[model samples]
Every structure is written in C-alpha cells, then in structure tokens.
Target: MAITDAGVMYGLLAVGAGLATGLAGIGAGVGEQGIGAAVVGVVAEEPGFLGKGLFLMLLPETLIIFGLAVSLILMFAWTPFAAFMQ
Candidate 1:
C-alpha cells in the first residue's frame, strides 16, 4: 500500500503537535524544578510564603498551556471546527 499526500501531511502535523507538547512538558518540568527547590527553601524559612510559593510553582503551567494550544490547533486545523469558529 502507498501513503497519500494527505496522509503524509497529517502525519507531519501529528509529529509537530507531539513534539510541541512533549517539549513544552519537558520545559515545564525543568522550570518547576528550580521553582520547587526555591519554594521549598522559602517555605522552610517562612511558612507564610506558602501562597506565594504555590503561585510561582503554577507559573510553569503556562508553557504546557501554550503547547496544548499548538497541539489542538494542529489536530483541528483540517477539521470542521475551524470553519465553525470562523
């Protein structure tokens, strides 16, 4: 069997979305690592920093959000949803 051009295009898009999400997740993990360490240290020094520490830790989630958006766009670019949104 032979793969069609449409299949090849979709395959590439899938790869792109996968890469975006995977890399973003990895970046988020790396970001959280430093923030986590700092938050732990800060909390150890002053428990009052709990709210601030948690807030900072959550900031890394933005990376994952962006990745998810890219993934969604890639996955839906050819779908009817695109037309519906316009």
Candidate 2:
C-alpha cells in the first residue's frame, strides 16, 4: 500500500522511540561495563566493600528506566497529539 502522511508520521515516531530506547540501553551497558570492572577491582582488594561497589554499578541502570518511560510516552501518551496532527 502507498504511504500517507499520517502513516509516515507514525513510522517516524516509532523509529524515534526505538532509537531512544536502544541508545539508552547501549549507554547503560557501556557505563555498567566500566563500573562493573571498577567494582570488581575494588571488591577484590577489600571484600567488605561489595555492597558499596554493587550500589555504584547499579546506578547506571536508571538510563534504561528513563528510556522505557520515554518510549511508553511516545507510544501511548502522545497518541492524542498524533491524532491532532492528522
């Protein structure tokens, strides 16, 4: 079928949402990798520091959560604006 304006807009929005989620996930993964390495090193030096190391490593995970929220908003909360645009 031929693509209409509204269809194109919807596709663009979907792509944008996907990008946001994907990028955030990538960033979180990269960040966690570094932090995880550091945490391991720190823990290796002092076993009692495990809890603090774990906390620091987990902090990067918020990027994924924020990305999920943005994706959800784009998928559902933005529907009204999409309809209005069309």
Candidate 2 segments exceeding 4 Å error: 1-4, 79-86
- Provide the overall lDDT of each model, using Cα atoms, as 2-decimal numbers: 0.86, 0.86
> How well is each residue in 1-86 modelled by candidate 1, as lDDT tens digits?
66556657667778998998999999999999999999999999999999999999989989899998999888887574355436
Structural similarity to truth (TM-score) of each candidate: 0.80, 0.80
lDDT of 2 by residue, 1-86 (tens): 65567767677778988988999999999999999999899999999999999999999999898998898788768965457455
Residue pairs that clash (backbone atoms under 3 angstroms), model 1? none
- Candidate 1 lDDT for residue 57: 98
Which regions in candidate 1 have their CA more than 4 angstroms from the true location? 1-4, 78-86
lDDT of 1 at 34: 96
